[model samples]
Target: MLHVNGEAFEVRDAAVGESLLFVLRERLGLMGTKGACEQGECGSCTVLIDEQLVCSCLVLAAGAQRQRITTIEGIATETPTDVQRALVDAGAVQCGFCTPGLVVAAHSLLERSPRPSESEIREELSGNVCRCTGYGRIIDAVQRVAVSRASAREVGL
Candidate 1:
């Protein structure tokens, strides 16, 4: 059994060597987690295992039992998150293959730091690689979300 997106899914058919990325995309039908390089080098298959950002491609599905797994699909409700909106507004999404992972990474960084420095954002998101938009816009998106969130907090909203 694997706990994903606040739900429990029985993964009885997962092989010992099967990766969490495969189980998430194939068995669970959570296509939000993209699979680029099957290796851990690419963060396209990134997810949160117990609130920690991880490359799902490097994780074992069966090994994730009892752990909380949050995918891009679980990050927001019906509407897009502030980070997601900022990413779009900043024109950071192109090809979109790397967006999910970048979103997850940025979300994790903001959750921990709330208002991170430019270098901090770059360091945290270093794992994700976006070939389409370079990285300037992606950094801008994260910074934008951080500022927006801070403003919301100040207004008690």
Candidate 2:
């Protein structure tokens, strides 16, 4: 059994057949996690395993016996999350197919490195692919969030 997003589930007897994406979508009904390029090329199936970004499609549900899993829904704060707000502010969200994964990746990077440089942000989000927005806006969004967080930290707010 594992606890996900503060919910307890019985997976000890669960079938060892499906991928984590299938179990998350089919069994748990956590639709926020997307499935694109099931081969793990795209980060659409990205999720946090102990706060690290991982492709859910490439992971086996049974392997997550006692790990903490955080999906896009779970990572979202009551305040729309800094990355979410920055994406919207920078007009980075388009089509929205990639936003969830992008958000998760950005969240992971921000958590580990609060004030990452532009190159660092790019490296961290390299796993995610977006067909819209030309990536400029997305880059701008990430930078904006990093700047904002840095300012907050400096001001002790």
Candidate 3:
């Protein structure tokens, strides 16, 4: 059995050794999770399993069974997590290939550290590689999100 995107599924008879990335993009059509490198080195396949970021390409689909997994689609459909909106407003998106994974990583970081410092943001996102934006803009985006979220919390907004 599997529960994905707020839905229940019966996968008891399904294959036992498929990567979560394959099941997501091939079976479920959730292609927001990129398949870059196909290895765990690049964080492009990042997804949240029980709110912790993991490389879907390296994770077994069976291991994700019953766990709450969040992908780029899930985040985009919501109110655009503060990190996402900041990324856009900060002009951090270029090429756009790495945005989804970066967004997922940022979401995990914010969930755990809410007010992460610049160095923390850099360290957290080090695994994700971006060919455009030169990373300066990406760091700025994360910092912007952290600041904006802090302000919102202070005013109870």
What tens digits encode model 3's per-residue C-alpha lDDT throughout 1-157? 5566677666544577888888888778788899989888888899888877889999889888779878888777757777778889999998889999999898888889988888898899998989888899999998888888889889999
Compared with the true structure, what per-residue lDDT tens digits does model 2 show for residues 1-157?
6567777776544578788888888778889899989998889899988777899999899888689988888988567998999999999997999999999999888888887888898888889999988888998999899899889989999
Clashing pairs in 3: none
Positional deviation of 52 in candidate 3, in angstroms?
1.3
Candidate 2 TM-score versus the reference: 0.93
Better of 1 and 2 by TM-score: 1
Candidate 2 lDDT (Cα, whole model)? 0.87
The 10 consecutive residues of candidate 3 with the worst lDDT sum are 5-14
Task: Provide TM-scores for the models.
Answer: 0.97, 0.93, 0.91
Candidate scoring better on TM-score of 1 and 3: 1
The residue-by-residue lDDT of candidate 1 on 78-110, one tens digit each, is: 899888899999999989999999889999999
Highest lDDT among the candidates is held by which one? 1
lDDT of each: 0.92, 0.87, 0.85
Candidates by lDDT, descending order: 1, 2, 3
* lDDT of model 2, residue 148: 91
Stretches of model 2 off by over 4 angstroms after superposition: 11-15
Residue pairs with clashing backbones, model 1: none
- lDDT of candidate 2 at residue 27, scale 0 to 100: 78
